[model samples]
Target: MKKDNANASLQARKEAATPRGVGVMAPFFVARAENSELWDVEGRRFIDFAGGIAVLNTGHRHPRVVEAVRAQLDAFTHTAYQIVPYESYVALAERLNQLVPGPHPKKTTFFSTGAEAVENAVKIARYATGRGGVIAFTGAFHGRTMMGMALTGKVVPYKTGFGPFPGEVFHVPFPMPLHGVRVEDSLKALQYLFKADIDPKRVAAIIIEPVQGEGGFYVAPPELMRELRKVCDEHGILLIADEIQTGFGRTGKWFAMEHHDVAPDLMTMAKSLAGGFPLSAVTGRADVMDAPAPGGLGGTYAGSPMAIAAAHAVLDVMKEEKLVERANRLGGELRERLLALKARVPQMAEVRGLGAMLAVEFCKPGSDTPDPDFTQKVRARAMDRGLMLLTCGVYGNVIRFLFPLTIPDAHFAEALSILEASFAE
Candidate 1:
């Protein structure tokens, strides 16, 4: 095989072998990846600003995380935590119970993916409150599972063609002041749902992402969070913070929910939880978590020893490296750069996010119309210049930056330069 045609050949093979629904962005296939860089099979180096969709806060193959997984490989791989419990699982759960926000006693359960954690969270909420209805905000992305689809607001790509989702799931507009959706409007919609749609008493949980991920990097208003907590208290609904993309120090804090004054009743976490390993968890009030009977929750790979070891190493790396603080510093610098560039790049409608989880929305220069085409051009130009990027938003006009917190100073600066160049005519 010619080295020059490696990517093209792989692309052909991928199209033939894989389902089209997977939706891969890059045209090249990766040969290897380090902290903030990866080389394609054709020996092309690209600075990774996507961070594997927010799963590499500790960066690719961090020495400690790799070593921890290797150590676990020698001991034992799988015993099925349900069948034979392990000390590591319990210890990690204990750590989370303490680390997760909230003054009340908490309990945690492990899962293999964010979707699994979300599904289990709803189950726990329903069992705890004895309700079947759930409310999710428009533009919020929970996951890709059936129930996740039902809970998610966006229809294209994720929920398209796959219909007949789980019933009793409802959606209200998420407040995006830029898009004319206000905090008051969202609360009123919730009230309308209670009066017209489902009874508040029948609602199990109200799930949200403190910072919307796929629907663009819109931050949830503090006022909205406070009101939701009050509504949950008034009724018997559980408040679930979906922190899958914003967890593990992506948002300058351990979790995005920390940005709010009020704490959620339940929280779903994944992505960077295990420093790129497959691990997710649901942590909530001890009483609420205990609502489900034993044996009711637990997957074959729910709490694999390998992932547990990776998670422990991830936690250690976060604390020792002070990643949470790094997030704020890095985010501040990037925010400043993007803001300064806005005057030159008229299409840059807004730059928003919490901490390092930032995004720049593109729109028509004079009007509020979304410019997905302009957004794509920015992504394409960046890719051509050897910088990888990711886009989100219902209109596909937002460029989100998910570079690893562990990215080297030189690499990050180079990527930023490439990003600024991407806006040039």
Candidate 2:
């Protein structure tokens, strides 16, 4: 047997073996990765600003996470929590229940992916309220599943040919002042939706990302949140916070919802929850979570023992290393740098997001026209200089930074340099 350890070969194989729907951003194949850095099969090193799409808050293969998984590996891997439950799963649920917001008691259930968490959150909301309608915001991204796609707002790549999506799912504009959408506009739209589209009483949940993830890193306005909570209370509609991308200290707090005053009835979290392990959870008001029947919830691989163990270690590492505070510090520094760069880069339209979950939108110089081409150029230049970056937004004109919270200080500074050079070139 011969080992063909080349990125070109692997990329060719991947293209031939995989479908076109699964987009590949980087042309290189990863050979190894560590905290904030990865080497390609060609042995080229690149600073991982992508962070596995915001999954590696603890960085790749953190020693603590690795050790915990190793220990769990020796004991057992999977027993199907719904069949033979494990203590670690229960313990993790307990931890999440306490960590999630709201003064009332909470309950939690685990899933394998963020999409699964979103799907189950919807199920729980409908069961609890006995309603079938759901409201999501435009430019929002829930997931790739049928139900996830239905709840998602953007339609190009995520919903182009996948419909007919699940019925009774509605969408309203999300507030983006730069894009001319205001909070009042959003509220008025929601009001009109209730009047013209679906009755408020028939809506089960109003799901939103505290910081819109794939829709571009726009922070949900606090006023909007307060209004949503008020409306939910007024009409028995449950407010579901999709914290999958903004949870586990990526946003400087345990969850982005913490940055707001009101608490949601339910919250879906994943990505960084298990330090790169496949674990997602939905924590909500105890009664709301309990609405689903005993056998009504769960997955075959939900709450795997290994992922549960890794999640425990992720929590420990977060506390011991103080990653939450680190997020604020790093995010502040990045924000300052980007703001300074914005003065020089006329195409840089706006900088937004909370904590370390930051993004910069690109537009035609001195104009509102989205410049996705400039955004692509910046990403390409950064990749050429040994840095990885991600682009988002409905128009694909935004550059999102998702560096690991545990990134080494020196590496972080180097990535910043690469970023500045990318924009300059």
Assess every candidate by TM-score: 0.99, 0.99
- lDDT scores of the candidates, listed in order: 0.95, 0.94
Writing each residue's lDDT as its tens digit, candidate 2 over 1-425 gives 12445777787789899999998899888889999999987778999999999999999999999999999999998889989988999999999999999899999999999999999999999999999999999999999999999999888899999889899999999999998999999999999998999999999999999999899998999999999999999999999999999999989999999999999999999899998899999999999999888899999999889999999999999999999999999999999999999878999999998889999999999888999999999999999999999999999999999999999999999999999999987
lDDT, candidate 2, equals: 0.94
- Residue 231 shift from truth in candidate 2, angstroms: 0.2
Give the clash count for model 2: 0
* Regions more than 4 Å wrong, model 1: none
For candidate 1, write residues 89-153 as lDDT tens digits.
99999999999999999999999999999999999999999999999999989899999999999
RMSD in Å for all candidates? 0.7, 1.2
User: What clash count goes with each model?
Assistant: 0, 0
User: Which of the numbered candidates is closest to the native, going by highest lDDT?
Assistant: 1
* Model 2, residue pairs in steric clash: none
Clashes in model 1: which pairs? none
